[model samples]
Target: MRHQPFETWLLFDDPLTPDQARALDEHLRACETCRALGHSWRSVASLFQASPDLEPAPGFANRWKARLVQEDQGVLTARYRWQSWITLILIANGVSLLGMLLGMTFFDTFDSLTEILLVLVYRLTSLLTVINIFQNLLAILIRTIPGLLSPSGWAILALIVSSGSLLWVLSMARLARMPGRA
Candidate 1:
């Protein structure tokens, strides 16, 4: 149609206010092209209405659940498929870094690396001393734990742990029992 807005209204499903609807109707009556387009759209709408509504086959829910589980498992498996190779590459990289560090520390064949090597060894020894102190404290804690407690103390500790675990399970059960929640 020569009238552009009426042609748009005829070809597409556009919302029409009362005034716009009246103008479109007036245009359609005078324009043969717009009238033909409207008739075609109505025919298409009728065809769609005449078609039967289709439903999925039986066991749809069970089948859907099975498919979902299968896809999840497949994704999980694929995600870890390169685990060994990735781990191997990571280990190789770490070892290479460590070797490079050590080489720069002690493998200085020439005296040019001597100064840097001494500085690094001094820093490393200080770090090791701190680590050793922490390790000794942890060892002392482990050794004294049993001796610092009597049979009654052990029983009390066990009672506390059991009560806490029971409370946690009860809370989880209550949450699962709530409406609109799993």
Candidate 2:
């Protein structure tokens, strides 16, 4: 049986059936591209096996466990900060909407339709404000988190934030550049 080029290379990593293995072997023998690919895969696998495995210093695991705890605490603290901000924003918006409704009803102002429209506008504005505030607070917290100053901590934080930002930007750019929703 014949196999496609990718399948031939893929079989190198698995327990191939006798016929599959024979097919791949024949293909590699005749095709320089497949042969080179097989050789490269073997070279990578051999290097991984031959590399030295270094044991960590005494108490290394304990130290790592302690660091992990610290990182976890930092993450919890960050989450709490954001949660508090969101709660506050939500409460404030809810109160504002309640007050607006009370004021409108007590004063007996505007027709029913006008009152409904005004309330809708007020709700939308409040929602936008809450989102804006939350984003700003989150940015500030990410920038100020103290653990981020450590080399490893900074790398971890940067990797997380940068990848998130890159993905957001890429998605937005893709949307903007698309021909149409279709």
Candidate 3:
């Protein structure tokens, strides 16, 4: 009969049958790997059997619950900070753009609608440039903040802002260059 692999040992808790026992004994004599596996399994089983079963301290569950709550709060706080910052930046940019258009259209007298629209477009472009400068400055400040200064954090922030600005500029430029538009 062929020798049994060590994995077969896990199938039976009681003593192996005569043929199976003989096969395992023969394999263990020839294979150091199988012998070591069997030894390790027995050692682990013995360790589990030897250890005493005891309940944790009275505050253990409470401590773990508190820890989980703290972790959740940390995640929520970070999410809210990011959202608020983005929202503020967006609102500032939108208000600035709208103010520029209103100033150019209503405050500055133009002889024709075309002239007024052209002025508004020019002002919008100028406002976008100003916004970009301010956004870059903000990114630099974020990167330099005392406890938040990390190369990876700065790199990620720079990447996100740069990509966003690039997309915004490209879309705006395309719209500005479209023929028949004021």
Candidate 4:
């Protein structure tokens, strides 16, 4: 009635001793359940052996990989778009809040709209005055700098700069070429 060794022997690929094989054959003859199991197992194994190995068509792997990448890119693009929308909305809200706060403060401090306009004009005038001062200074420097240096002086300055650059380059090259430095 016990089917332990006989079932294991029939199902497994382990080789059986002559005595074990004889005992298994005797058990198979008497045990209908084990005999049917063994028969089905052999039939399934034969089916597997007779069938050809299935392979994908050419470029199938490449197509599948490309599809995966495309899906990932779609997901990333949507995420980026969502983030961009959120950022734009937040920035708009912040600008609106700042404008409202500044307007309220300015209205509370100033008596009239004309005062606000005058203050804006004064600030713009100050900024423009500073810019104009810098522009005039730049113009003066541009006019006087060339007069300060003769042609030979300019050539000497260029030579000095080029020699310094060449020295730096040669030092770097030597450092790079030194062994055990990497």
Each model's lDDT comes to 0.89, 0.83, 0.85, 0.96
User: Model 3 off-target regions past 4 Å?
Assistant: 1-17, 25-41, 53-55, 106-108, 111-182
Q: Which stretches of candidate 4 lie over 4 Å from their true place?
A: 17-19, 58-69, 72-76, 107-182
lDDT of predicted model 3: 0.85
Against the true structure, whose lDDT is highest? 4
Candidate 4 Cα deviation (angstroms), residue 175? 36
- Greater TM-score among 2 and 4 belongs to 4
List the candidate 2 regions with Cα displacement exceeding 4 Å: 1-52, 109-182
RMSD, candidate 2, Å: 27.5
C-alpha lDDT (0 to 100) for residue 154 of candidate 2: 76
Cα lDDT of model 2 by residue, 1-182, tens digit: 34485455564566778887787777777777667766788898899999998988899999999999999989989999999999999999999999999997756865677787888899999999999999999999988886547888778988999999999999988898888542
Writing each residue's lDDT as its tens digit, candidate 3 over 46-113 gives 99999999999799989999999999989989999999999999999999999999878685676878
lDDT of 1 by residue, 1-182 (tens): 37788878777776889998999899888988888888989999999999999999999999999999999889878877778779999999999999999887665654656776787899999999999999999999999998988989999999999999999999999999999773
TM-score, candidate number 2: 0.33
Q: 49-154 in candidate 4: lDDT tens per residue?
A: 9999899889998999999999998998999999999999999999999999998988899998799899999999999999999999999999899998899999
Poorest stretch of ten by lDDT in candidate 2: 1-10
